[model samples]
Target: MKMSKVFRLLFIGMVALSVLLAGCSKSNQATSGDKKPNELVVGQDANPTTMDPHDTQDTLAYGIQKTMYEGLLGFDKDMQVIPVLAEAMPELAKDAKSLTFKLKKGIKFQDGTDFNADAVKANIDRLKDPANKLKRASLYAAIDHVEIVDPYTVKIVLNKPFAPIVQAFAHPAGLMISPKAIKEYGKDLNRHPVGTGPFQFVEWKDGQYVVVKKFDGYWDKANAAKVEKITFKPVPETASRIAMLKTGEAQFIYPLPPEQTESVKGDSNVVVDKAQSTIIRYVVFNVNQKPFDDKRVRQALNYAVDKDALNKVVYRGFASAPESAIAPKVWGFQKQQMYAYDVEKAKKLLAEAGLPNGFEITLWTPNDTIRAKIAEFVQQQWQIIGVKATIQQMEFVTLTNQLSLKPEESKLQAAVSGWSPSTGEADWGIRPLLSKNMFPTAGFNSGFYVNDQLDKYVVTGLESGDEKERLNAYAEAQKVIVEDAPWVFLTVPDNLVGKRKNLSGVYVLPDATQDVVHAEFK
Candidate 1:
């Protein structure tokens, strides 16, 4: 009540103190400092089928191995094709059918093996070996062989002038490993991996984890991984993985549960790193099957499911709604094409396909949580259209092997399968997945949807190096898949990555390759 100047100043000071206390209570920074982890650990969904880079198609293998190896060509941060191991990008012969690579001198493999033309030849020979059973055999099937021009240079002879040559070498499937290391370790490379990579294998506990230490001899060792050691422990269960992160038992994680992504949105210790990915989830329908053979049936399936509903109720809005078979992040997406959800339209289509009420279909899905959830959500949506889908769950390995069978032998009707990009290769979305030429064997085209136009465009896309021509060809290919509806394009993804604050350079590719070098735990 006393209006003295000193009292007024005291009252103002008291008000300031109150505000400061309230601010301190809410301030995250006041409690503690954010400390970076000392090592970078990763969680992989699966183990590598082969440690030999040339003989494996498993993406997890590539992700872990890339930190330890280099390709003749590489994609920069901008996805521009450039030289990595080579002195410069390979020059195509006048005919453009032959690729000549000039190697960098004084380069050494992790095993201290000489890196030369002979080393390149040995690696090429191993990739060509049929006994290896590599998943990417088709990518190299056309290669005539490697010809060493000299110790520092070599030439690759293709049967024809195959374009996308720069793209081919940059794919994780195409990275080079030391020939000496392969000969010494053979397939036991997992336990004793030797590469030009920045890290060296320390131990691997199958289904548990893998550990690696920094290889000080790496070409970019000074700027390479900062961690002294890394451990990759597996907690396959979604809840368990998240629980590990909460307890600080795990420093990094992947594919954070759809519902749990929000938990790390702005935390001081943890972070959610989101990026566009080449992964697309969809329900793959076998075109060779009876009901699916009818385009109307495929359209019905696409129309019945509300992708918005799936993203909301199932994915909790953590995923984006897919519009086309090719992801929007990938070049050549056909924007005008998408199968809109129309319950009545789906019903009419089903009726047109001679099923007025509904049809029974078997839906196969992996035992994993996300995939199972997607299948269940799709199953619910199908019920609205009178289509009853019975869920059959199996492990990924068994499920994938089972899916790759003759339609007659498949014993299941429609199944949920996802497509992923290969260094942003449109062929990853087209040929090997939809062409009759790749039916049930070469790749995911287990559905055997043979559109002559898709096949021609796929070939054309793969045959041309011109960006305009290739993109135009892929655009046409996307149109074919959308119109054909061989599969219900569900959602393209933003990769869900949760990491400790200290890890830098955690390179996650638009494709599936994950790199740790250039990453340091500060």
Candidate 2:
């Protein structure tokens, strides 16, 4: 899974070239009085691992996939859920098992195909397809059947009254696809996508760039992206991303670190915005390991690490100390009143576990400044407890692979990772990472830290859309995770974006949306 630096560098260079093309494009003919281009050019670090919306599990993938696909529901300016493809929120039947959705008419796929109830069926059936190979298949497994009541109406019958179904539609796995496109292209439809969205797929040069063009036939063209062509360039380094932003080589950076926030504060031409991000960073314990297998050892690790110090040194005060896996921005988040940085307590717990002298363990992270610095801080903290720590770094996807190994097949002892909340809820952040049933038998829950009590609360939170009930369930789950300490809860990131003076609409919501979607020059 590793590649030579030469190829990686070349790939980066090509991405730089793509950015230059987007910055210099004359196609679609959008220009200002100063003759600036109308096309919105964006930059990222790498190509999305998978373009198939349902197969991806990262913010980058969700951000890109959202551009070309519309879900049954979508988040608005305030991140409030509203109907898009759906004319109205589904109405629950008296039986409570059947949900009926009224579809919006006059919507057409990018390929001039009509969109109706049949299209909805096609979209849902694909993700529900047993052979689809989509990672999110489990989300829809309980769906009994979908009946098309009319051209503009569809009814979904579930095995149970799943109230969170509306929010689930906002997930990438629930993005609506063109039935004709899928039927014609089969599995390759991900590469060659067709949807009823603001943008249409144009070209994707592997590991370099992904380009999309505006669709003239979009239903709501008024708020349709102001720009013409949108090109996303993969630029991995923060300094490089910030440097290029200053040069006007790139208009918007996905995330300019907190370290650079103050640097850009004085620059009138550049603006920096910060808000609590739904993404939470943390270090996970491999429960299969003997020391970590003991709840006392896990809790001790939590007490040993200084999250505040780690936040200051690594995140430059751009993060909030997370008491649990879910961020403070989420509704009904139980604030862990205080994080215990008790060296004596940690030592005592280790002694109780028959390891007074401490033990050696591997702490793994992806190769990045924030990750590496955080690992160094944890390494120092572990040292105080008389434990020798070995720090290792790998690619983000590689780390995902190691932690995703099956129970008996896992090689990782512990790793640093976190979730980017795609659905803007704790249900997404906690369930998929900790719940045994959410991930495949050999997938992300490779830590195999099963707690039926925790699973019950997470499921309860997800099954009911009733705000009070869901929030209470989430609060209970957070308390359990804090006491259990399967992972060292770190901090909630502040979404930081640096944009040139000319760029407009550079916004960040604490959810899955991560792209510079509507960026434009004044």
Candidate 3:
């Protein structure tokens, strides 16, 4: 009996040992598999002031929002409008007063709410609400009301015939937020974003980084999020960003300084992408203030600056001199050389403007390396015409706030800035910058420059149904704006981008934002 008991105990011990070894083997295999690819890290030069789509006016902020929120429509690589949440391109009524959109079926928001026509209506109502005070309200000023035809169909009625309404829907102004999330978060929705995009907002570490993760339940699984995670690190210093890219810490960086392009290209593990951009850098004269109020003074400044030399020196030959406010790729862009580098003509114009001895002025510029260089170059050139130019640099947000203020309150004489129309339309590019109705804190016309003739042409371009008429109207408006010289047209910069060699599916849109939804590590 004692021998039988001992044998049974031995058998039990062996079985237990076998089970322990099997469990260890399985755990080892799982651990090896869990070592997946690292997340993609993108380095940006600026941090977004807010994440709310309706409140943000900065491009970087919009780029971050694009990862989490999607509009009814979106722009393709060629800048053409394409349907996103919508089933197809919206059908316009014969009278051109309404647009009907068929929403994609079976889509659900990240917050588990059903996405329907009512959600679209709710988004529009929130944006159009005066109590919300959205900066993008002006973009949807033409919307009379939204009608839900069914669970998956909606119609947007316009107060009048507006040409840019369709294009506006593709912009950040048309980004659809989850109504359920909005109701829950309310004023805090900027930080708590919920949408039906391929990625979901994970967390935002203030002044450090904003992180996002792939949404497994994304409707479009074919082009679903490839990367497991993405972290947008705010590295304002160009050198730091370059260092991060080289050390394999960051996979992408924007606005790569022209000087560093060659070095980045020399690296075997990195690549550079250069695309023609719609960004126009210019100096906005405070027409509400002295000397600048005179067209002759503005024209003289435009003539005095050697744009070609500025492009070569500041942009390192990576920029093209703009003929007008609109870029060359934009329709209705004039090929005419509106202003040539003529010191003598500039001097003559200054004398004609009754400032023969030249007047002292302060030129404000954002605290950006490129803009600062441009400002310094302009200051030197203006000195040749006896203009005592003082350069003052401030943060971009602060400068924009000062520019938005009334001339008496802001004391802004002139500021160096740039504008990129995200809509990819000439009407959008010209209207907000030159229209009188857009002045005094209405959609980026901070210079407060007003021209009745230009405004009329812009309005006609926005209201006309015929393409040729709209083209002619915009062309004429450009000519008038060049003559008025509200801004000294400088150069259209090339979007210089840097990325790791292993990073694929990254593209710079015409509007100069990175499309990283399909980005992956090879």
Candidate 4:
């Protein structure tokens, strides 16, 4: 699908206007050169909505929380599961129904609490408690209970055979919090964190910065922090973040804006780091709403837009069109045929659906540059097919609230968002977003997408450990989802970062989380 001349001109004009606005905007003059050598300041795109790991759904918060918390299992840069607090890899039962882990002894939380089987059981119990209402409960719903075998050993008994257990523990939601703190702070634990990781939480000045200091008694000395203190500062403006990096105001920054990648590459003071990411972007349709409820209307929307153009224009070629519902970097990802761009086909589908004149919709998007651009481009494409789209851009928090509305109460027609399988597996990639059991307030199924066949296929994949069986199940699942057209699949963006030349051991993981524990200045 080639981009129309008018679309290309609109994109160029938008880019020029953004550049002009950036030039006219005032810049902050703060510099980090005078700071102590042992302190590392990092800039992120936005402030995390919450500091509590279990309560957070945002990626930036998880990255910062990881520095303070340690999970039984962890993921390396390649997204492979490895042991962090556990003595070694867990022992799985033959039926894939249970997993046993040997806890590492002589470990203590930052608050001087003992780390043992009891602590593990306590955390799991809290998550499983229906009264707590944690958003991640669905991921662990298969767990029947946690059995304490000994002071240093624990067993997780599952209600059924679940294949993604290990990957689930490696997720940020899987990161363990201090049981003692859970008791002491209770609901206030979101502001107070105690963990056994290399860094201990210092303070979180909401909407400004989160501070952490080194833990002198960390268990893993080899992976311990090199710096005494690390500060995560939220700098929302892309140009301001880049300027800070060049001026030494920030030593590192996650998500170097895609449009600025080439410009940053030529800078001698900054080095560009890239990782294959599991983050997939798409526009989700509210299937419970009018026009979108019809499969033909959904499929027509997918056919109207050119995904290749979206990647090139919005991502500056830093992304690729998705071949599967999940990114190829994730485990169990299977390739499937995607929709080809066809304006005429979209028109025909709309006519067949008894709406030859098309319909009007309120398209919601966060006020981020990339998402806004994608929304604008899509709006133009849909206009060609007689669809009138009114874009409503809001703050990230506001957008989240709107998306989180109950299906019956929601007025949203469509929304532009992205999902990263923080666990780096297909189960985490597809289940929460597409499954019938994951509707809002439960999981992230905000679009209210449901298909009986898809739900069964997802369960079938989880019920076995056999590679071929899971592959076949996921392949069928992908085909069903594509045919349903619940979303206009966009791109799997590359994880790009910018850091000072002297910074060492800081990089974005394939799951879009940061491994900043071993970071230091050269």
For model 3, the local distance difference test gives 0.85
Writing each residue's lDDT as its tens digit, candidate 2 over 1-522 gives 987999999999999999888877743223232236687667665556666776666677667777788888877655678888888887878765778999988999988999899999987888788787677766676588899999999999888766566667766678887888888988787688787878888988875788988878888767687778878877766677777666566677776766777877776667786777878888888787788899989878888988788788878998878866687776557776545788999999999999999999888987655677778889999899988889998866566667666776777788878786666677777777888775443235657778899999987886675779988898888888888888887777787877766777657678636655565678
- lDDT per residue as tens, model 4, 1-522: 988999999999999999887766523233344333688889887777776888777788888888889889988878788998899999999888999999999999998889999999988888888788787888889999999999999999999988888888888887788898999999998889888889999888976899999999898888778999999988767888888788777889977889998898897768999777889889999998888899999999999999889889888888998898889887788888898899999999999999999999989988766678889999999999999999998777678878877788777789998898888778888898999989877788999998999999999888877878998888899889888989988889998899988788888887777778888887
Q: Which stretches of candidate 1 lie over 4 Å from their true place?
A: 1-37, 46-49, 181-193, 404-412
Q: What is the lDDT of residue 209 in candidate 2?
A: 81
- Report the lDDT tens digits of candidate 3 across residue range 1-522: 356888999999999999999999777643431233558889887666677887766777777888888899999888899999999999999999999999999888998899999999999999888788777787888999999999999999999999889999999768889999889999999899998889999999876999999988899888899888999987767778888887777888887878788889998878999989988999998898889889999999999999999999988899998878789887667665489999999999999999998999999997767788889999999899999889999867677678766545768788898888889888878877777777645567888888889888888888999989998998888888888899988889999998887788887787777788788877
Ranking by lDDT: 4, 3, 2, 1
Candidate 3: residue 117 Cα off by (Å)? 1.1
Q: What is the C-alpha lDDT of each candidate?
A: 0.75, 0.76, 0.85, 0.86
Off by over 4 Å in 2: 1-35, 441-443, 463-467
What's the CA error at residue 1 for candidate 1, in Å?
A: 72
- Candidate achieving the largest lDDT: 4
Measured over all alpha carbons after superposition, the RMSD of each candidate to the real structure, in angstroms, is 9.1, 8.5, 9.2, 11.0
Clashes of 3: 0
Q: Best TM-score goes to which candidate?
A: 4
State the lDDT at 185 in candidate 1.
79
**Is candidate 3 or 4 superior in lDDT?**
4
Instruction: Note the residue pairs that clash in candidate 1.
Output: 68-197, 358-386
List TM-scores for all candidates, in order: 0.86, 0.87, 0.90, 0.91
